[model samples]
Target: MQLDHVTLVTHDLEGTCRFFRDIVGLDDGPRPLFRVDGHWLYANGRPVIHLVDATGPARLSGGSSALVAPRIDHVAFRVAPGVEWRALVERLAAHRVPYQLTEVPASAEVQLFVALAPGVVVEFVTSLPVGAAA
Candidate 1:
């Protein structure tokens, strides 16, 4: 089966939404009426990122609170090289978001990492032509 959306539980709902929208270029879109406060971030007409407000008393299946200490290492997205990749890099710099880059050995792909929050890291992978610079 194909991959679906990624959900993030955060105390800072508006800040998280801003990061996804202003930095990652995702659009704040429609979300169904759920009891919890949250937002749906869309990319290319699809809701790719779901943000849930964790400031309230919601608990997970294990009875633990959301984002008390995030267990996820990072979330990655495949991006186009050239213009798209460059634009993302520019946005990160413009917003002063620190990031690190790593080139995949034996592959034309490069991965860029940025920590959006204490435990929320975002990675962008861009594939370039062989022999092309990142």
Candidate 2:
């Protein structure tokens, strides 16, 4: 089976929305009528990131103000070839978000690594289409 989505808890829903939408170029997708303030970010017409507000309508999980980060080091999204990256880089610069482009060893593919906030690292692995991912 393939990957479905990655869920992240955020204290600032709007900020996280902007981080993924404005900075990462993902569009907002429809979310279920769950009793929580959250958003679904879609890429390749699929919901990829689910953002749950730490202080939303209901405490579906932990309700502390402490930033809840992903347990794993990072969540990676495979990017399609020919994706315009200059604008993304510029957006990162505009927001003062630090990032680096790292080439995957033994392959021509490159990975763009960026942290939206402390403990919120997201990686964009380039040169792979949705269905072509292994």
Candidate 3:
């Protein structure tokens, strides 16, 4: 059994899409019109991220980062090993998004990233041993 995707609750669908596209380098597909309110984004042909518009206002939190809770602290993506992770960081910096880099426990891999929103974090992990795709 593998992880399929994550549904994020947001008040701004277009803004979230822009965060993933411009900051995280994910492709932004066509805006999906729903009876409720939401949009879908695919990573490598799989719908890995879904943004559902919440029917309320934004609940401002006082946390420094959004990785404090367990309810989908963040969504992680895999990239090719040895890729220029710094370039991605620079791109995110140019966009003025705050992020932090860390290493996964028991592994020599580095995850790069930034905040998707005030309480939404995005993680880019590049340690899927060769020949692995999800």
The best candidate by lDDT is 1
Top TM-score hit: 1
Q: Encode model 3's per-residue lDDT on 11-78: one tens digit a residue.
A: 78789878776766666566557777777777777677778887764443784454433356777777
Model 1, 50-111: lDDT tens digits are 99998655455786657344367789999988999999999999999899898899998999
If ranked by TM-score, best first, what sequence of candidates would result? 1, 2, 3
Range of the 10 consecutive residues with the lowest summed lDDT in candidate 3: 63-72
Clashes of 1: 0
Please list the C-alpha lDDT of all candidates, in the order they appear.
0.89, 0.78, 0.70
| Alpha-carbon deviation at 30 in model 1, angstroms | 0.5
Q: How accurate is candidate 1 locally (lDDT)?
A: 0.89
Question: Better model by TM-score, 1 or 2?
Answer: 1
TM-score of model 1 relative to the true fold? Answer: 0.86
Model 3, CA-based lDDT: 0.70
What's the TM-score of each model vs. the native?
Answer: 0.86, 0.72, 0.69
